[model samples]
Target: MAYAIRPFRKHDAAALADLTLAAIRSLGAERYSDEQVAAWASRHGTADRFVVRAATGDAIFVASDADDRPVAYALVGMRGKEVGHVDMLYCHPDHARKGLADELLAQVEHHCRAHKVTRLFTEASELARGPFERAGYTVTHRRDFAIPHEGREVAIHNYAMEKPLT
Candidate 1:
């Protein structure tokens, strides 16, 4: 099936939140407990924040859909000094392994190139590392953080990955 990719709209926030939460929850039974997932989802799933971020020209939110409903989305931000950051990249669990993330990354890279960005960076979870690596990102560091969920802290380890854009 063909996917439609475009800039995020204010009305798309609710859909984006759902997609984000779904991606997080799909990490599996052991990666994160239900309590942790629920907590993180509560904060990150806010449609208002997505709208505000999209309104900021510095950030770009792109969504890919089949049949006019979003199945994947990515948020990219241009940092200072020719640097770009992938704030988030999520695909519905059902859509995983179907090249949607790759397409979204390609779009972000194209945006970076058009704007003269020299480097792109992302903090990728273990589950996401392989795809980023295949797309040419190299891990520069590994860090552990406590992600707050349901009034408790859930430890999550992720890699700081970077790739040259130019």
Candidate 2:
């Protein structure tokens, strides 16, 4: 399916949050307890919060359909001197593997380059490592831990990946 890539808008916050939660659940729930997942969702999935975050100059890009409904997104920002972070990147489950993620990443890379960012980093779940690696991010470390979920703790591991964009 064809999708339009554009700057994320304040009105897109709710949809963005929903998309993020859905993508995380679809890809990482096995490693997260229900409570932990719920807690994280509650904290980060609010539309208003996303609006505020995006309004502050954080570069957010969204992929939408003809109707302007968002189907995928990527959030990127500079964290420090020469360091850019991929805060998040998600595509609707139905839209997976269609190159939306790549498009989003490209946007982020462009943003980083514009800012003269020399390093780009992101934490990738097991399912995401392959794609990030293919995109030229090298795995720097892997860490395992338990996250609080619905009623218990769940085990999960994440790979810290980085790419030199300079």
Candidate 3:
């Protein structure tokens, strides 16, 4: 299906949050245990989080369905005007593998270029590593961390990837 890539809107926050949870629960299960996936998904449980991130100067793009609802999104946090970190990239499971993410990333790269950003990076989950690599990002290292879940720390890992925007 063809999806439209556009700048994020305030009303899309809740849908984006839902998309994040669904994507993580479904796709993350392939690479992470149930507990780890749950832990990761919890961090995105609030729509206000996206609002705060955008208010803090992050650039966010959304891929919308025909009805103009968000099915995917990409958020980039700029660092000192020369670097950007892809803080989040999520697509609803129903829309997976449809090139929506690639389109959003391309839009992000275009935004970064206009702002003179020379580097873009992300800590990509296993499910996202291949897509990021295919998007021309190189894996710099593996990031291992733990998140609090049900009173314990759940272990998780992801790849640190970067691409030169120059």
Candidate 4:
């Protein structure tokens, strides 16, 4: 199936929220334990979250189906207008392995470059590590952390990766 990459729209917020949860519950289950998955997913809010992020200056890109519905999306943030951060990237399970995430990331890199961003970094989930690495990001370290879930701490680990755009 063919997909198009474009800047985010307000209506896409709900779809992005749904896609985010599905990606976390589906693909995220492959490498993460039940507790970890729950904790990770708990961090995601509703469509308002996406709207707020976009409103706050984060650049969001969406990969849409031919019908104009979002299938994958990526969120990027710029700090001091020079450092870029890949804050979130997710694809619906049905759309996985179709190069959507890759294209979205490429769009992000291009967007970052256009804004004079020189370095890109992210805390990449285990499932996302391979894709980020393939995009030329090197793992800086394995970041182990914990999140509060249902009154207890759930442990999780992801790679801290970075790519030099210069």
Error in Å for residue 163 of model 2: 0.5
**What is the C-alpha lDDT profile of model 1 across 90-166, one tens digit per residue?**
88887878887787888888888998888899998777788888889999999788777656787767799999976
Best by TM-score: 4
- Which candidate leads the pack in lDDT? 4
Better of 1 and 3 by TM-score: 3
Task: After superposing candidate 1 on the true structure, give the runs of residues whose Cα lies further than 4 Å from its correct spot.
Answer: 28-30, 33-36, 59-61, 79-83
Q: Where in model 4 is the C-alpha error above 4 Å?
A: 79-83
As a whole number from 0 to 100, the lDDT of residue 35 in candidate 3 is 93
Flag the better candidate by lDDT, 2 or 3.
Answer: 3
Predicted candidate 4: what Cα RMSD to the true structure?
1.3
What does candidate 3 score on TM?
A: 0.95
lDDT of 2 by residue, 32-71 (tens): 6565556555546667766765776678889998889999
Worst 10 residues of 1 by lDDT: 57-66
Each prediction's whole-model lDDT (CA): 0.77, 0.77, 0.89, 0.91
- In order, how many clashes per candidate? 0, 7, 0, 0
Instruction: List the pairs of residues colliding in candidate 2.
Output: 34-149, 34-150, 35-149, 35-150, 36-148, 36-149, 36-150
Give lDDT tens digits, candidate 3, residues 28-115.
Answer: 8988999999999888768998888787788899999998889999999965542589989999999998888788888888999998
Candidate 4 per-residue C-alpha lDDT over 76-106 given as tens digits, one digit per residue, 9 for 90 to 100: 9865542498999999999998888788889
